[model samples]
Target: MLKIRIIPTILFNNFKLVKGISFDSWRTVGSIMQAVKIYNLREVDELIVMDISATNNKSKVDLDLVNEIANETFMPLTVGGGIKSIEDVSNLLEAGADKVSINTSTFNNDFFVKEASKMFGRQCIVASVDYKIIDKEIVIFSNSGKVSQKVKFIDHIKKMEALGAGEIILTSINLDGTMKGYDIETLSKASANVEIPIIASGGAGKLKDFTDAVKNTDVSALAAASIYHFTNTTPRDVKIYLNSEKIPVRIN
Candidate 1:
């Protein structure tokens, strides 16, 4: 059986590590490099670093900063934000990212995901799907949750998988940075629909939340930011808890 992964997320904005409730009211957490160095010692399965401002600013991901973080990250590093072209993917991979997460570009360019996947291989492409519950419905959002894609959540992930994305990072805009818990219903449905690995993101508040999602859903990995940023709980703590609950995790 594939061991469940516990990944820590770094939301990078204006060169600082920040977190916010429901994707707004952003506040700095600490230095980006500082966070990466800390996770390196935590036995995390992987690390996701997103330049949350790059897309809104109409710029590419900060390769220099990614290179800096990549140098310190001991595990696999997935970098995202402002990834619009195959060149951007290539640059990120060259800069030390084990994978690149694509969001806005998947909606805007149409062919970028397919092209990037074909050129770089699907394993290097992580399609990021950010959504909000609108009128009791799941709506896909892009441009860092500022614009709605007007696409159904299930259709979007299926389309991304068909387009050659190796995995999907499903984040709930409603739950992001809230640390209340994950959107388990949506996560379970998504995992049922996709053959690719699904990284359950957003709203991980405590240790029970992690085990809850893993026990109830078929998600391959769990990703969180605020829980790690605001709480004393480490990734290893999460793994140990999951292990106690009979969930398979890499404890060392």
Candidate 2:
């Protein structure tokens, strides 16, 4: 059995770690490197650090900062935002990212997934999908959730899989930072539609929420922000709770 991964997602504004509600009204969390150091001490299974600025600013990947964080950690680091082309993916992995995640750039250039996966291997590509409830239906959001891709949520997931994206980071823009709970209907639909690992993201508020998501849906991992940023529930605590509940997770 595959041990479900407990991932702490760190968002960066410029070089500083930041957090927000519904992907807006951003606030600083701390320095990027410091956050990674804290997670390292916690012996987290993996860490996902995203550059929240690069896409909005139309900038390039901050390879220097990414490299600095990568140098401080022992586990896998997945970096996203500002990933535009194959060379950018190359630079991220070269700088120390175990995998590269792409979102906004994907709509216009999905072939990047296929080409990068072909060169870097499928396991190195993660497609971050942000969805919102529009007209009571879930649809893909792009440009940091400010715009819609006008693509049906599940169809996009299928496209990503067909294009060779190895994993899907499915996040609910409506539930982001709300601490309500994950969007299970969306998670289940995506997980059922795709054979690749699905990283269920957004709205993870407490320990039971974690258990409920995995128990109810076969997502490979659970990723969250405010629950870890604002609460005392560390990823290790989550793993412990999951183990007590009989959920298979990698324990330290």
Off by over 4 Å in 1: none
Cand. 2 TM to true fold? 0.98
In model 2, which residue pairs have backbone atoms overlapping below 3 Å?
Answer: none
Write the residue-wise lDDT of candidate 2 on 9-108 in tens digits. Answer: 9998878789999999999978878889999998898999898788879997688988898988899889999889888999999999999999988898
User: Which candidate wins on lDDT?
Assistant: 1
Report RMSD (Å) for each prediction in the order shown: 0.8, 0.9
Q: In angstroms, how far off is 143's CA in candidate 1?
A: 0.6
| lDDT (Cα atoms) of all candidates against the true structure | 0.92, 0.90
Worst 10 residues of 1 by lDDT: 35-44
Q: How close is every model to the real structure, measured as TM-score?
A: 0.98, 0.98
Q: Give the runs in model 2 whose Cα sits over 4 Å from its true position.
A: none
User: Would you give me the overall lDDT of model 1?
Assistant: 0.92
